[model samples]
Target: MRLEQKYTALLGDVQRRAIGGGVPSAIGQLRLCFEALGLASAIDADCATRLGRHGLSEGKFVLLSLLRDVPEGLSPHALAERAGVTRGTITGLLDGLERDGFLARHADQVDRRKLLVRLSPKGEAAASTLVDEHAQWIASLFADFTPAEMQLLSALLEKAWRKTDRGAA
Candidate 1:
């Protein structure tokens, strides 16, 4: 069924089962949450498809994106922190990317004990293309919104995100 039909039917069910029209604005919020999940899933699929064309997974692409501008490269620990992953996870990702010729690791000049990650020429090209494509895809989604609508949407999303932040309470 269409998303609107699914939403309407769910809301109707809620109305039938509850008093006062289903939790006083919560149904609409629930609908928005569901819509957001759908959007996220679509974006994930799009990302996977695009990355698949290059034989890269999300982790590998993230490393590529991070390394694209860092000709000097980043330490494994720093890249892990920036990528919001653990040192072990970064190691695994680096292994695959290195094997795929997307990145290179070298001993740091300042700290010989530490290694830094840098992108290969092929990786740089892929990163540039993927970043551009991703930006265009994002723009297409918001192209229909008016400037005011975009501003309102941004503010609302910020507010909602702040409310759900770790220390919000």
Candidate 2:
């Protein structure tokens, strides 16, 4: 079924089940619907499935994407901060990536205790290929949207992001 039809059905159900009389409560429920829809879209898009078929986890994909522009590599601490993860989580991601030969860790010249993580040539190529594919998928997914509609949606989402607990990106 079309997404709009699904949304309409769900909204009708929500309105029927709504307990409060005020418009504010109804608006709050609608906001929750938007959140649910966003999550459902993400999962249904199956970005993770595509990445997995390429032997890449979401964590690895994120790391590779971040490392693509930095030939010099980034430190674990920096990567963790940028990725909004803990150092331990970074270690886990690095371990898998290293085992897959997609990335390598080198001793920091200035600090022997520190390790600099960089993507291998294979990893770089993979990153480029995966990024292109993902972009194409996203473009196709939104093919029905007009340029103006996309711009407006982007602006609205950006506004919501700015208000989120994570703050602006």
Considering every candidate listed, which one attains the maximal TM-score?
1
Q: lDDT per residue, candidate 1, 1-169, as tens digits?
A: 1355666678677766666554565666767766766677777988888788889888888888888788899999999999999989999999998998888899999989989888888888888898778678779988999999999998987777777755386
Residue 92 displacement (Å), model 2:
1.0
Per-candidate clashes come to: 0, 0
lDDT for 58 in candidate 2 is: 79
lDDT scores of the candidates, listed in order: 0.82, 0.82
* 1-169 per-residue lDDT for model 2 (tens digits): 2345666676666666665543334746565656657666776559888898988887888899999889889999999999889989999999999999889999988989988999999999998888788779868877999999999988987776687788654
Return the clash pairs for model 2, or none: none
Instruction: State the local distance difference test value for candidate 1.
Output: 0.82
Q: After superposition, how far is residue 40 of candidate 2 from its true place, in Å?
A: 4.1
Per-prediction CA RMSD (Å): 3.2, 4.3
Candidate 2 Cα outliers beyond 4 Å, as residue runs: 1-45, 156-169
Best-performing candidate as measured by lDDT: 1
